[model samples]
Target: MDKAPDEAKEVYSHHGVIVKKLEKYNERESACSSSTFISFVSSGTLSVLEHNNDRWLLWVPEERNLSVESDPTEWEVVNTEKPKPPSINDEKLESRKIWINVKDLKSLQLRRNTNKMFFDLKDGTTFDVVFQHGDAQQFISSFRSFVILERSRRSRQKFYVKGCVNRELSKSFAELDLFGEQGNLVARFMKDLHDRPFETTLTAFSKLTGVVASGLSNTLRPDDEMVSQPSLQGDEYEVIPSTLDHPAMSLPPRPTIKRGDPLSVEEWMRHVQEDGSVIKVDTLLMTIFRGGIDPVLRYDVWKYLLNYIPYNCSQTEAAELRKKKIQEYQTLCQQWRSITPEQEDRFSLFKDRKSLISKDVNRTDRTIDYFAGDDNPNLESLNNILMSYMMYNFDLGYVQGMSDLLSPILMLMDNEHDAFWCFVGFMEKVMGNFMLEQTSMKEQLLQLACLLQILDPVLANYLNSHESGNLFFCFRWLLVLFKREFTNDDIMVIWEVLWTDLPCRNFHLLLCIAILETEREEIMANENGLSDILAHVNSLSMNIDREAILSKAEAMYMQLLSNAEQLPIMACVTLGLPVPPDPETGDHEEHLKLSNMTPSDDDEDAFEKAMSHTFL
Candidate 1:
C-alpha cells in the first residue's frame, strides 16, 4: 500500500492512493480509455489534505532535508503544462500536484478487470488513482459525500446571497470588481476554478442579486401605458426596469436556456432538419435522452424513432420510402384478406391466432378515447393491423400482449401502412418479450433480480420470504414496455425516451427497478407477501409518474456503473457493458446476487452531477 505524506498537513487521510490522467476524447465518445498518466514525485512524501469542506488538495514534496519539516498550510499550484526544469535543479520543485474540487469532478470510474480508479474532471481531464480495492472504495465514498455537500452548499448559496444582498452588494461588488460592463468578477473566478457552466453560475448570481442583465439600466418608458405600443419595436424596444439597473452598470450577458430540459417542438424539428435531408442521429438521441420529445412533435418524431423513415434520408427520400412501404403493406394485407374461406380454414393456426388477437384488441386500453366504444373504426383498424402483423410474421403470429403494444403505435400513426411499419420497428426491439417460451423475458427478470440483490440485499431477502424472488410481477412491464402503467401521454413520453437508447441499453429494466424502489417502503412496512406485492404493482396502472420514473431510472444507471465490477454477467449483459473474464477457467463468469435497496434522491443528484462533469 502507498503511504500517506510523512509530514501530514491534515492529520488523517485514506492511504494506498494511485493517481493517473486520462487521454482526451470527443465528448460524445466513451470514457473507458485511460492511456495517459501523471507521474508522482520520486523522493518526497505525497500528501492528500482537506483543502476545505468541499475539496481535496494533493501536495508533492520537493527538497529533501530530513531534519526540516514543511508547513501544511503553505502550498503552490503545479502547472503541468510547463516543461521540466534542468535535472540538476531541485527536482522537488517540479513535482506534480493539482487541487481537485469535489463538486467539479465528473466520476470515479473503474477500469474493468483492473485495480485502477479514474478520477474524471469536469474539464475533460481523467486521472487514475492507484489504491487497494478497499482503500479506493473508502476514498471514493468520502469524496462522493464531499461532492454532495458542495452541491448542497451551492443550492444554499443561491438563496443565502438572496437573503443578505442589500448590505453586501455594493461593498462586495467593489471588492470583487463586479462593476461596469463586466458583472461579478468573483463569479468568473469561481466558475473557472469549479469548471461549471457559466450560465449555471450566473443564474445563482442573478438569484442572489435580483439583477437580470448586469446591474445596467433599461431604456424603456416607466409608464405601463406604453408597454405594449407597437411603434416601440426594434431599437425603440421597451425594456423592463428593476431596482439594480443603474446608468453606471453595463448589461449582463443573455441567459441561456437549461440544457437538460426537454426539447421543444421547434428545437426538435430544426435539429432534424439541420443537415437538410439526413438527420443527425446522435444529436437527436442526445436531445431526447436529456429530457424527452415534446408531445406535439411525437407524430413526426415517432417515424424516425421506429425506423419507419431512415435517419440519413433526405425529405424527398423519406417520402419515396413511405410511399413504397404503403404499397407493400397494402399488398401484404390484400393477399391475406383475399384468402378463400376454405383456404383460410385450412390454416388452423391462423384462426386460433386471429381469435386470440380479437380478444386482446378488445380487452386492451378500452378506456382511452382512441380505442373506446363497441363499434369504433379506430378499434376496427387496430384489429386489422394486428391481424396484418400476424400475416407479416406468421411464425411469431399474434401473442397476448401484442395488441397492447400495437394500440399506441396505431393511435399515433393513424395511417394504416405507417402504423404497421412503426409497430414492426418497435417489435424488432421488443421481439424477445413476445416469444412463447419467453426466453428473453426470463433473462430480463433474472437480471432485474440480480440487480436488486446487489443493490438491496435486504429487499431481495424479504422478496424471497414472500416468494416473489423470481420477479414475475414485472412481466407486464417488460412485455409491453409499461403501456398499462401510465396514461397515453405518459406512455408516449416513456416510449420516446426509451427510443433514444442513450446513456445505456435496457433502460426499461432500470425503470422497472425505479418503480419497484419507489414502492419499497410500502412493501417492506406492510410485510407484504408475494401476492400482496403483485396486487400492489398491478394497482400502479395509469398512476405512475413519468418524470419520476425517468429520474430514478437514470440514478439506477449511475449506481450500476458505480459498482460495475461486482456485477453479475447477466447484469452486465443487461446493461450492455463488458463482462470480465474469470481467472480460473479463462472465460467470463456468470453469477447472481440476491439483494436490493431503494435508491434515495441523492443518487439522482450525483448522477446529474457526474453527467454534467463528463459530457457538458
Candidate 2:
C-alpha cells in the first residue's frame, strides 16, 4: 500500500521485469551442440524463467514456435506439449527481433526462443508488479521491491484463472508511489494508459498474466485525427488537378477579402475536415492512381493550361470514340505481353487487383487480377492505360474522375499508351477543375450562367429573381468531372467529345446552360421556390438524353465562342479562389463586419482605458 502514487519521493522506482524458469517441467533431448541452443518437435512444453535481467530474449529456428497459448483469444490454457531440451550455449547473441522494434505486440515469431527459457504462463489470476522508491544507499531513502511476507510465501504461490473479480493487489504496477521532478511523465502515463505502448515494455508483462494486449497501441500526439475505427493501414497523400468539362458552368465574380484578419490553422483544419463522399472518393482515386501508375509518376509536373475547345459533336459519335480507345488499350497490353512474362515491365501492370483502401486487400501481390477468371488481360490492360497516362501527364497524378475516364477509355481503345494520350489531350482544357484550387469549377459554372443568359435571358432572370443564382449544387458534377452524372457507358461518349477539344473548352458549360434552358421555362413559370429548380437541373444528370444534351451543348458552345468578346471574363479572379458567390449575395458586408474584430491587443487595452471615466 505504501507504493501508491508512482512518483512520490517514497515510492517511485524502476525495475526490469521478466519471467524466470524455476525448474524444468517437461524434459526432452537437445539437438544443437551449443550449451544454450535447443530444438524440439512441433509440440514443446517449457518452463518460464520468472525473473531475468533488464533485457531478455529467446532463440528458435524460423520453423519452430515459442509456443504461446494455442487459442490466442483464450490464452488461459497452455496445452502441454512434448518438450525436448536443446543443446544450451552460454550464448552466441544473434537475434532478428531485437534488431527491429516490436516493444508492444505480445505474439510474434521473431525466432529466438530456441535456447532461451521462456514459455507460456497461462496462470491468469491477474495482478501487477510494484517497486518501492529508494536512494542509492538502498536504505536511508527507500524505493525498491518490497513485498510483505504474506503474499508469495517462502517459495511459490498457486494461482487459478477465472472471470475478473477486481481483487485489489495493493502492490500493483498502477498503484505506485514516487517522489520528485519526473512526476509529469508518471502523471501522463496514468492519465492515458493506451500511450503505454509507446513508452513501456509492458507487452511481456501482460502476456505473463494471459491478459490481451488490446490497450497497448495508441498515439499520444495531441492533434492526431481520431477515427471511429482505427486502421492498421499506413497513410499517404498526393494532390492532382482534375481534367474534363462537366455539364455545370463556372462561377461569377468573387468579392475581395480586403486585407483583413486571416483565419487560423485550427479554423482551416476544422473547415476542411467536414468532408463528403466527394472527398472520400478523392482520397481513394488518388491513392490508386498513384500506385496503379508507375511509382515514378509521383509529382511529375504541374501545368494550368486552358486548351480551347470547339462545338458540334453528337453523343453517338462520342460513344464511337470510346470504343476506339478501348481497342487501342488492349493492343498495347499485347505488345507488352510479347516482351516477357517476367513481370519486369513495371510500366504496365496492375499494382494489385484490389482497390486502394480496401481492408480485404492482401499485402502481397497487388498486381494480379483475382476476379477475371484467374488471370484475365482486361483488368491488366486497364491498369496499363492508367499507368501509361499517369506517366504521360504527371501533372494530374490521377483524380477520382480520371478512373471513370480511364474505364470507359479502356472499353474503347484497350491499348494502354494510345488510350492514355487521348485522356491527356482531353484533360488539357478541363484539368483545371481538378486543381485543389477551385479555378475550373467556378469559372465553368459562371461561364455556364453567362451562356444561359445570353441564349435565354428570361430563365436567367427567373433564377436571379428567386435568389437561385450561383448554382453550387452542380459542384459534385464538376468536381467528379461528370463521372457521377452519366451512366457508365455514356460517360465514354461525353468524354471522347471532350477530349477532341471540339466544341471548345466552354462546351461543357454550354451543356449545363442547355439543361437549364429546357427546364428553365418550367422553373420560371412556378414561383414556389428555387430548390425545385436546382433539383430539376441536378436530376437531369443521367436522365438527360446524351444525344440531345450534346447537340444543344454544342450549339450553345458555338453561340458563345462565336460571340467571344461578349463572354464573361473568367469569374473569381478578384477573390483569388475558384469559389463563386451566392448569385444574389455579396461578401463586402461580411468583410466589413470582420474588420471591426481585428484591433490589436494594445489598442484594445488603450481603448478600454479611455472608455473608463476619470473620476472612477
Candidate 3:
C-alpha cells in the first residue's frame, strides 16, 4: 500500500521504534477486502494481525518485530493527524532563499522512515542521520532528528536546519537536500552534540573550502558588489560594503538581510516554545528574536540573558567547585594585566596571545575600529555577543577569531541577547577550540591534516615541504568556523546542512577531502610545493564554486575509510568542532567501552592533555 488509510487513529514510539495502527478501510475493489486490522511492526514489515471488515495492513522498510510498547501512562490517543510529504519539482535555489513552507506539513515529508532522517545532497548522493535533541549527553541515547545546513563561500559554517518542533518527538524535524531519487546518499558523518544544537550545527559546517554563492560570479571572478547582506532582516544595519569583498572595486553594495525571511531565529524560538521538550535554550536567541524591533536594546537583553545562564552556575553542589574556579580565572585575568609579556608567556594560556583580534597584517585601524564600538551599528551587538559568550564559555576565555563568529551572527540578529544565545548555541561545539587547554583544536588540526595527507599525498607533500605540513595556517579557516571566508548568507546554508548531524559532524574532514578532490586535477598539473600550495590554496578564495566543491566533498566523504569509533573525531574535523579525541586514548570506542569501566591509555592521555597540562 503506497499510502495508509486516513483512519490510522493511534501512534507511538516504542523503545526508539515507531508504531502505529491503521483503522478500517471498506474499499470494495481492494485486494484485501476483508483484512481490516493492521499494526506497525518494529520496522517496515507489516504482518496481518487481525483481518476483517474489508481492509488491508502494511508497514514500511519491512523488518522483524523488535519494538517495545509505549508506557501505559504515556499512551494516549488524540485527534492529531499525520501529514503527507511535499513535492518539489526540479527546484533551483536562487539568491539563497530556498524557504521551506512552515505551515505546510506536506513540505516536511523529506524524512525517511527507514532512518531518523535522510538527505539527497545532489545528483545521486544521499546521507543518513541519527538525530538527537535534549540534554547533551542524552543526545546519543535519544535519537531525535538532525540535519546540517551550509553557510559560507570560499569557506564554510554549518547550521542545524529542520522543521519546527512537533508533539510526538518534542523536537522539530531537520530538512535536507534529497539526492539520487533513491539510495545514493553518503557523506562523512559531521557532528554530534554534547552541548547545544547550534553549537553542533555551527561546528559541523565550518570550512573555508569552497567559493560560496556570494563574492564570486559565474566566471570565477570577483563580483564587485559581492558583499553579502545580513542573513535575516539585515536591511537597517547594512554598513557600506567592506573593501575586503573586492580589491579593485571601490565600493560593493552592502548586501542586506531583510527581516522578511521566513523562519528567522525569532520565529524558531516562538515555535520552539510552542511545543517541544523544555531544552535549556540560549535566552540570547530568544531575546534577540523577541526584541528585534530595536536591536539597540540588545545590551540590556544581554544582561538579562546573563541571568538565564547563571554566572556562578552551580546547578548542584558539586558545581560549587565551578564558582571557585571562576574566581580563580577572574584572578588570572587580573594578574595577567599586571604581568609582563615574558611573565605571562610562562603560562601557556597567555603566551603571545592576541585578544579576539585578527592576525591579518593588512587590516587597518578603520577595519578594527569600524566594527568595534558605537560607530558599528553592530557594535552593541558585538558587545553583547562577546560579553555573553565570555560569561557563557568561561572554559575558553575570550580569544581571537571568536569575534568573527559573533560578527556574522550579530549581523543576522541585531539584538545582543539573541546574537549572544545564537553564538552560545554556536560555541557549544566551537568553544573547546578556544579553550586554554587547546588540545581539542590541536587534535582537530592534526586529524584534518592527516585526512588531507591520506586523501592527497601530492598536496600533502607540497604542504609538508613548505613547513605547512601541519597545515596550521588553516587555523583561521577553522577558528571562526570559516567566518573569514564567505558572506553571512552563505554561512547560513552551510550551517543549516551541518546541524543535521548526518554522516556525523566530522564532515569538515570531507571538506579537506573535497578540497583535495577539486584541486586534484590542478595539483597534478602544477607540481607545487608546500609554500606554493599554500599560496595557491589561499588564493582560491574567489575561484571556487560552492556546488562543485560540495559535490566533490560528498564524493570524498563516501570514499574515506572512517570507522564507527572515529565518528567523534570525524565530527570535529568537519567544522572546527571540539571533539577532544579522548586525549587519554586518542579514541572514542574506548571511551564508549570504558564509559563505566576502568581507565586505559586513552583515559590517561585525555587526563594528561586536558588536566595535567595545567601543571605544564
Candidate 4:
C-alpha cells in the first residue's frame, strides 16, 4: 500500500492479499458484465487508515520499487530511491484500487476451510478477497480493535458491526423501568435500537417525549373533564394541534376482505367445454382474481393466463399451436447455440448477454428442489429459455430480473417450450420495467408516490420531508413484482392475481400502498430516513403476510371507488378509472388531450402525460 499521508494514522497493514473478485454496484441492476469483472489474481496490500477522523479500508496493488520496513506502519522506496511516472497500465491498475469507508461496511462472510472472505457494503458493493500468505485471522483481529464485531446468529460465518452509541443506548433503555411492569415495550424498543441505530434513536425520542408531555397534560386537566371523558381514547387526550391529526388527512376505514380457496383442478375443468374451449372467460378471470389457481392446476391454467394457449381454441387447435410454438422455440434456441467461437469472439454484446444469462441461471432459485443440485437439467433449461428469449426479443435481450420472472414458470410447466412462451407472454406485460432508459420503472415509482399521497398523505408527507418521496426503496418490489418479498408459493399467487389485470389497472401499485399501510406505524415509528426505510423494507423479504396484503390492496381499491367523485384526474388515470369531467370544461377531452401531449411540452404537461401512461 502507498505510504499514509502525514495527517493520516495507520491502524493496520497487511501484505500478500489478493482480490479474487470485484464488481461495481448498481442497486437497480443485479446483472454483472465483463467490464465490471477484475482479473482472478490481482495481488495487493490491504491497509486500514484513519483520515479526517473517519477510518477507511483500502487496498493498493503491489508496485515495483515499493518496499515496506520491519515496522508495519512504515514504508520506504527501494532501488533508484525515486518514484517513476505512472504509465497507461499503471493508471488503469490505480483506478481498480479498493477504498471503502469503514462505517459503510454492512457484513463480512469468512469462507470455511479457506482464507477467502466476502465483504458486503450497504450500497450493495461486494468484494471477494483471499489472503495469499497467512489466514484472515490476523486481519479480523486488527479489524475488531476499530469496531465491535458480532457474529450473526443465523449465519455462523457472517459478522456485522454494532456501534458503541447504539450498544450504550440499548443498555440505558433496558435499565429503565418507566415503560411498564413487564417492560415488553422497552424490550422491543431496545431490540429495534440495536438493529437500526439512527432511525430508532429519533423514533424513541419522539415517542418518549410525547408520552412525557401527555402525562403532564393529563395531570393538569380538571377533575370535571377527566370524569366526563372516562371513555376517551389515548389519542383523544392530546392537546396538540398537528396536521396529521386533521380529519382530512385520515383514510377511509379499511374494508374487511376474505380470500377464497385456490382454484382446484375440478373447478378449472368445469369451465372447459367438450371442444376444450373455455366458457365464461370473464367469470373464469374473476375466479382467478379472487383466488389463485392450485399449483397442480398451474401447468394447465398458467398457459391460458399467459396467452400461451388461447382460451377459445379447441383441443385440436391447441395441440397444433403447441407444436408450432415448440418448433419456433427450438429455432430461437438454435440461434445462439449455433454461434461459433469465432463469431462470439467478435460479437461482444452477444457474448456479454450469454455470460450474464449463464451466471444468473447458475444461482437462480438454487435452493428450490426443482432447480437444485449440481448439473441439474433445470438449470440448463433456464439458460436455454433466457438465451432463446434474447433471440426472440433481441431488442430487450436479457436483464437481471428476467431469471426471477422465468424460474417459476419453468418449474411449473416442467417443459422448455411452454416455459419459454409463457415467459414471453409474462414479459409482454412487464417489458417496460426492463427497458434501457427505465422510463416505465420511474413512472411506476411516481404513480406509487401519487397513490400514497392520495391514499395516505401522512405517510407520504413523512417520506417527502425525509428525502424518500421518490419511493426508490420499493424498486425491487416493482422491478421483480415482489419476487423477493414473498415465499415461492406466495409469489405464484400474487403473480397470477396481477396477471389477471382485474379490479383495476396498475393494481400492483395499490399492493405497494397496501404494504406501506401495513408497515406505516412501524415505519414512521422506527424509520427516519431513506436508508432506514430501505433496510426495513428489504428485511421484510419472505416475512410478509401475502393474503393480508392482497386483501388490503383490494380494500384500498374499494375505498378509492367509494370516493371516486372527489378524487383528482391523476388518481383516476393511475387506477384505470374513468376520468371525471373537468368542471370548467364540462368534459374530459381537454384533460385527455393534455395527458396525450408530447414530452417536449412544458413540465406540467409532461407529468400529466407520464401519469396517463403509467399503466399503459
Per lDDT, the best of the predicted structures is 4
lDDT of each: 0.55, 0.34, 0.36, 0.67
Per-residue accuracy of model 3 over 1-616 as CA lDDT, tens digit each? 1222355322212223223321332321132223332222222322211111111222233223332243321212221233322322333212211111111111111222223332222122222222222221232222122223322111121222322222211111111111112111122122222121233222222211111111111111122244543321111432222212222311222222222222244543442332332234444343232223133433323322323233223345324543554454445445534667677556433332333222211121124444544345555445444544444454455654466666655655555544555566667767666653344555566456545644555655555443445453454456555544444555544443343343345665565556656776664456554445445565565355544554555455544433323333332334333334455566755433322111132453332222110000
**Candidate structures ordered by lDDT, highest first:** 4, 1, 3, 2
Which ranges in model 2 have alpha carbons more than 4 Å from their true place? 1-377, 387-395, 465-467, 480-483, 487-490, 522-534, 557-616
CA lDDT of 226 in candidate 3?
43
lDDT of 4 by residue, 465-486 (tens): 6656656567668878998788
Score candidate 2 by TM-score against the native: 0.33
Cα error, residue 52 of model 1, in Å, equals 65
TM-score for all predictions? Answer: 0.53, 0.33, 0.37, 0.59
Regions more than 4 Å wrong, model 4 = 1-252, 593-616
RMSD of 1: 26.6
Give candidate 3's error at residue 55 in angstroms.
86
Q: List the pairs of residues colliding in candidate 4.
A: none
Across 480-513, the per-residue lDDT of candidate 1 in tens digits comes to 7887788887888788889988679788888888
Question: Which segments of model 1 are wrong by more than 4 Å?
Answer: 1-259, 273-276, 581-616
Candidates by TM-score, descending order: 4, 1, 3, 2
lDDT of 2 by residue, 1-616 (tens): 1111222222222222122222233222222223322222122211111111111122122223334353221122333363634643435222221211111112111112222222222231111111112211232012112111111111122111111111121122223211111232223322212211211211111111100001100110122233232212113222211111112333333222111122233322332323210123233222222212121221110100111111122345434655665666566546534554345435322222113212111221223233135345655655555555544454444433454445544444445554465556556655775553233453455445444444665665556456454444454555545665677555644553443334244456665666667676677765835456545655565676666666666555444444443232231121122232223454544322321211133462432222121100
